[model samples]
Target: MEKVELLEAVQKEEENIIRWRRHFHRYPEVGFEVENTANYIAEHLEEWGLEVAKNVGRTGVVGFLKGGEGKTIALRADMDALPITETKETDYQSENIGKMHACAHDGHMAILLGVAKVMAFHRKFLKGSIKFIFQPAEEGPSPGGAAPMIDESVLEGVDYIFGAHLHSLYPVGTAGINLTNMMASTDNFSIEMIGKGGHAGLPHESIDAIALVFRMYQEIQLMVSRNNDPLEPLVISVGTVNGGVATNVIADKAVLTGTVRTQSKNIREKIIQQLEDKANFISESEGGRCNVQIERGLPPLVNHESSSLMVKNAATKVLGKEKVFILEKPNMGAEDFAYYLEEVPGAFYWIGAGNKEKGMDYVMHHPQFDFDEKALINGTKIFIQTLMDVWN
Candidate 1:
């Protein structure tokens, strides 16, 4: 399948692709409450001649296309939107108020749906099965859509799973991927300090909670600098800190909240336990009580070498070799798609959606974030090429 042939085929259905994307953009849903979104996706999948299964993982829809199976491959598109109020003015701007598809999930769903329609029409040409997975809660309420879908045995016969995310950093017509370690795991930690409050004028009358905060900040940096491996990428950032009410008063309580990111699971665990140890040591020694809280988030996404190579070859075939390139390093950003790669050998790719000329190059999660719809066609073509090449 040459790039021109694939592009032409996908372009024929460009109107429906844009329509789907705009519809999702206008009416966005967040978390597992994507009922209308799930139904809309299911209706399309069912009408496309694929066996549709709804509520696979609580508001998630799965379309099973059994095309004279050899090996089963799952294509996933996230269905959740972010909890951001739309700031960009457009015809398809979010009407759902306070919810927007700022992460380009609207485009992801549109691409996969477009691929499904094309694959359904050419079912006889396929040698294997394709599972169209429309998942919910990618932005999360913890344990994201991928985990629950896996728990429901969504990948029971799946041999290789593939997922793609729209990246605003890359320009239109280019796709980027990493051979391994596509993204890092995210873990959250919070420290609460309690001490006796007193007037600032009285020097040694009270144990200061604010003092413990700085001491613990130094200890956290030391943990990252001295305890963790330098070769491995690790980041400990305190996003928020709260203490003290007045300038003349010594605060009795303080709270520090932040996130920890790492690609290696072992290193992530080590750093997490070390944070608790460090916070406890500093607070107790300062005659103050401290409580530590930890929340584990998505696992690191590491792509399989063979699957990655296949995607690279398929991408090269669809887009020129010059348009396809390997990423230099893994991203510290987290993705729930990491869950699917854990159970099945798979690869995740970046579908470039940035277009500064059209003013669609805002970074993801920003209220003004948007993407070039032209990239949706490339995403569909790449997916089509990847599947079709499997049988070639």
Candidate 2:
């Protein structure tokens, strides 16, 4: 089938697409609690006559649509929501308090489902197999859902995998298909400082742990500027700090938790080592003690050439050559989809959902974050095009 005809088939399912997205959005679930989401997806996959597997990675669901059984291609959609509360006033706003699909995983699921509908209808034309992966916990409660899914053999015998994210960084009609790197590697660290406490009036009698933590925070940036290569992308941010109780009393204990992001694993390791070393040095100098813990997160997402080329061509064919964009640089944001790329040759694309006039320009993970619903058609078509164009 031609690209336009396939997109037409997807467009016919627009109502159901929006229905699925809103249903998931209203009843948002977080992390491994995607039981409802998985069951919902599994029911649809089974209805389409696809072989369904539930709880592959706890709550993850994979649907296999075997055509001629030549090669298998995986299409992944994350099924988790963030911890933020919904601020939008729409009727479809989250019914679950303190949980929302702020990152647009709802849209991701809808797009994949739309693709599944189209693919199942056209299964006669498809020469290979298609696996629809509805993953849990893409928004990490650390280590993420992709690694566990892979551990359960999700990527076994998959020749090529394709994934897409709906981002509010560009206008709704455009899309980003990077030639190489898309997102950076992300890892987290926490530091706890222990010291002697005393009254504010006392100077030498008290060891200020908060002061040591502040100094360590300042020194971490030097690891990026002075130690790593200037061209190498790296970011260190302290997201949380807790310690002192009162202004009159010096803090005896303090804690700092943050994240480290880099494009290179070597740089990631070097920066982590410097963080621990600096924390120890600063604490000891202040007559205190420090403990640093580093937890590894997702690896950097780099698109393989063949799969990337397939997406680039399909996106260009669907949207036109002018609307197709190659990202100027990779983002510091991380994705668990990187784990799938580690196992198979795959590419993850970005479908633009930003429209300033529609008040849909909020970025992902923001409390007011949302996208133009029209973008769903484009995302759905892109997935369809990529799959059909894979063999061509």
Best by TM-score: 1
Residue by residue across 1-392, what tens digits does model 2's lDDT show? 27556767887999999999999999999999999999999999999888999999899999998878566789999999999988978979999999999999999999999988888888775778899999999987888899889999998879999999988988888888777888999988999999989899995899998887888777877776787788989998899989999999999999999999988777888888888888888888877999999998888898997888889888887788888898878998899899898889999988888999989999888889989988888888887777777765
What is residue 326's positional error in candidate 2, in angstroms? 0.4
Q: Each prediction's Cα lDDT score?
A: 0.90, 0.88
For every model in order, what is the number of clashing pairs?
A: 0, 0
Clashing residue pairs in candidate 2 are none
Q: What is the lDDT of residue 387 in candidate 1?
A: 82
Query: In model 2, which range of ten residues has the least summed lDDT?
Result: 1-10
Q: What's the CA RMSD for each of the models?
A: 1.9, 2.3
Candidate 2: Cα lDDT at 71: 66
TM-score of each: 0.95, 0.92
Q: By summed lDDT, which 10 consecutive residues of candidate 1 come out lowest? A: 1-10
Candidate 2 ranges beyond 4 A from true positions: 1-5, 195-208, 242-252, 284-288
Write model 1 residue lDDT over 192-242, tens digit each, in one string. Answer: 888889999984999899899888988888888988888899999999999
